[model samples]
Target: MKRQIIASINHNLGRAIALLDVIDSKTYQDTSIGPYYSSIGSHIRHTLDFFDCIISGLDTNDIDLTARKRDEVISTDKDAAKDHIYKIQETLTSYTDVNTDYLIHVTDNMGQGKITVNYTLESILAHANSHAIHHYATIGYMLEQLGVSIKIPGFGYNPTTPVNKREGI
Candidate 1:
């Protein structure tokens, strides 16, 4: 199970690195999209922030979802984003054999106030994977609006998506 979870995280990190190969800094940081006006880099950085929180909290078992680093360089610089992705991939790879059966406390602010919830390491890791994929789909939309071509065919798809659907049936 840990191996599978780690692989899923690595999969998204690989896609993020591949994205840098196709997009330049200007498009990466472009926030001129209409309506919500979110930049691709913003989504990418946000996606990474969740994983960062999990990894940082692993030792202490006190994961705080709202305490994101929100590194500006990662959001605006393609090279910085790539470097960060590589670091995350390395961290996840090291956790494959670690015991994840213990409970982890997760804290988050849901508009009204802060709340804490109990979670197993495995469960939160699963959430982080799902979270990254959700943001990747948003990045997909942002890239499309910016006229960027995706080199990875299933970069943002859910793993449970039917194989035929992913292949366009």
Candidate 2:
């Protein structure tokens, strides 16, 4: 079960990385219409930050994605963000590669109850995917407001994605 979950996360993260390839770094720097620390750039950065946090505990790889709260610029280099995200997924798969029956408990920092680290990993993946969707949706709206059509092909596949399978979640 763990192996299958890891494989799915790899696939989903791959898709997201592909979609991100289409995002102009400039677009990432664009601020959302009305929100704090809610620009496309920071949204991407934050997703990386949060996932890296969980993956650190996984001890597969140390992926630090935290950016200055005041600076919303997507890493001037988008590849770096993509590379880091890629590494996170890779390390996760490697970590789970040998463990088919291991589970570690950790307190849920925000939820109502405690859960296992393995479960936390899945939850974090879901959160990351949700963050991506929010950023993508906001970027879509921002683009439309600017009179530009979304260039990404799969943006229309789901108006809202709750089932983000194959990704880490």
- lDDT by residue (58-141, candidate 2, tens digit) is 554222233223223334457776787688788777766454243433334336544334444455555555555555555556
Question: Against the hidden true structure, what lDDT does model 2 obtain?
Answer: 0.54
Worst 10 residues of 2 by lDDT: 62-71
Residues 82-144, model 1: lDDT tens digits: 889999999989999887787899998989898999998778888988988887887877777
Error of 1 at 121 (Å): 1.4
Residue 61 in candidate 2 has what lDDT? 29
Alpha carbon lDDT at 158, candidate 2 = 43
**Model 1 has how many clashing residue pairs?**
0
